[model samples]
Target: MSLHPFSQRPRYSQWFTAKPQTVVVQPTTWCNLDCTYCYLPFRRLKHEMSAEVSDALAESVAAFADGAHPIDIVWHGGEPLALGPRKFTALLTPFEELRRVGRVHHYVQTNATLITEAWCELLTRHEFRVGVSIDGPAALNSQRVDLRGRPAFDRIVRGIDRLRVHDIPFSVIAVVGTDGIDHPEELLDFMAGLGCRSVGFNMEEAEGINTDRQQPTPEQAETFWRRTLEWSRCHAGELEVRELEYLGEYLRMIRAGQRVDWDRRRLDPIPTVSWNGDVVLLSPELADTTDVGYGNFLAGSVLDRPLTDILGGAHRLRYVQEFLAGLEGCRAGCEFFDFCRGAQAANRYFENGSLATTETNYCRVTRQALVTALSTVAAKEKEETV
Candidate 1:
């Protein structure tokens, strides 16, 4: 048996495993809305995963389970809710046993336009962690529209209202494009107004089908993050900001003289099982976005082998090897390696068109910028205390 090469790294030796901490399952590929920055290439195809596939996943996912930390089974989609409540519930049936045993926790990333009372009931009953995708207020959210190019902001907000009425807690994920970067406070206020438990930001990047959109300049990106962190600190305890929270954790790790610990093995081989059981490892955005150079990013299939086995051999794939090399590149050349790691595989592939390169606008803006801002803020706060 070959030892996973990642385990050889000191930071990964303790927790390296073939099983992924998160499994992204695509229930269906039919999205109800068209967002300007949407990355999915097959969103128009209304394909749904067969029950057999979910059964296979439920059976195989047990091997990935840790003691108290349930493996995250994220039901991502073109719009998972596009499957609607009935069809979606049938899809959930296979995982009920695992969910009951506390071995798996389900999360859904939805556009939230289809969020109805039935959807809220299903969400509440399943106890699934809900993540709603809405960029911001109506003016800021013009990018998200229906198939007819009708703005979806009002419908999205309506769905959120339903979730709130049902007491279904959710977190919001906003895509911060160049236009939205300058309006952090406005975005923050709008999202916080929705009563979401937390918020996360995704910078508009040249990824998948949305490659033509203009990205924020490095200076603008830095200013956005600095102000974001500043606002997050002021609103501390009111809402959790994902990037800010991650920054705090990273800073804490540094303060304690601890190595990064690979941050869940650098999220290696995060299996994204498509409707037909085809697995795309690492970045979920790579699903259905084929590059012949990268073997279409298809690592393996749950139909052919257990997810564990595929992940076990992930390091041997040619593209994965290049990605690992990219990590080394970051470690050696970039000072932010400990903070940003190698960056996301999709970012590397989409921005530079290779998994073997390092340093993307994404890592610079999201990771490096956030780290610098947080460090500066921490130092200033420390001085004030002294």
Candidate 2:
């Protein structure tokens, strides 16, 4: 029987009729630091969410958690800590209640500068998995400075030290810039010495508010990642590298005879809910656009629209379908699609004009570097076994 395009049945669903497994909630559009690479342009904004709105959002998410699937709530930009301790705790009450019944997991992605002793205590008390943003050591962190052109390394280090002193387990996220590309071994050593249990490395994405004049070239990126992997193999201690997480997950899928979720061009359409209850599709970078499809916040006020209505809107549905179709191209053609998440929508929007486009420059660099390194490692292992 000949396969029909529409009837072929995408390995993943074509549309989302249910709530997302993970939802990113922004408590305030305010941020303390002016990181050059921030996607939110948060430093320019002063919109703080009211406690009432935060409560309503929690209730809306709670409604979604009414289902059986595991749910994760991520406190995302612009610096969720800007919500302050009292408001942050207020926002947590609804989700925390759900956790009592063992129904929810909470995560926070933050720039460690705002991390205080109190914040560390609350995070550890609630068992929240924290991911701190720090781009390697002081020298490499020069680019990741405040608006006043002051290096934030000392403050960030102090914040991290507070976490350590308070016995709060946390992970580090380092942005790999051109400088970092030149010293992969040094960067890895710096991160390892921080005593963070895990680390995630992100290429300085040239998207949103991040208009960094200089970015690493594709060749530089490839070399940096290649060397980083070699360093990782040699230092295979308690350190968990987030960049390798997707690859590890993909390999796990292969071992289990299963397909990866993000790799299949599937739209896991993680919703980023702003403090005032506006929902943006995928990452916060999409929320930074001035264009129609760019800052397309389809669903507003979860109190007004049913979660079903928001997920089923024509714009959202079309975007999801188009995104999935784009993935089909990857699955059919790209050899490295299984390992990478086909590049992020934010990178595509910034580099190309649209999110539905084919492989991105980021993808090209990552796939070429990662696959080559993995192949070399596998071959060496085979030879050693022989």
lDDT of 1 at 121: 92
TM-score of each: 0.92, 0.87
Measured by lDDT, the strongest candidate is 1
Top candidate by TM-score:
1
lDDT of 2 by residue, 1-386 (tens): 12343543342345332457777877777777777667776555867766666677666666767546757888887878877887888788867777666567789988888888789878976778888889888889887677687888898898889888988788888888777879988888988999998887777767876765477777787677778888888989857787776677777887887764443344456777776677767556666456754336354556576444565452434444455556667667888766664546667667766656767767766665667767767777899999
Q: Which parts of model 2 have CA positions greater than 4 angstroms off?
A: 1-12, 15-17, 66-68, 259-267, 293-297, 314-318, 341-343, 379-386
Candidate 1: what lDDT? 0.84
lDDT of each: 0.84, 0.71
Query: Candidate 1, 164: how far from true, in Å?
Result: 0.9
Q: Looking at candidate 2, what is the lDDT of residue 218?
A: 73
Assess the local accuracy of residue 233 in candidate 2 as a C-alpha lDDT between 0 and 100.
Answer: 83
lDDT of 2: 0.71
RMSD per model, one decimal: 3.1, 4.0
lDDT of 1 by residue, 45-114 (tens): 8899898898888777977785677899999998999998998898899888888889889899999999
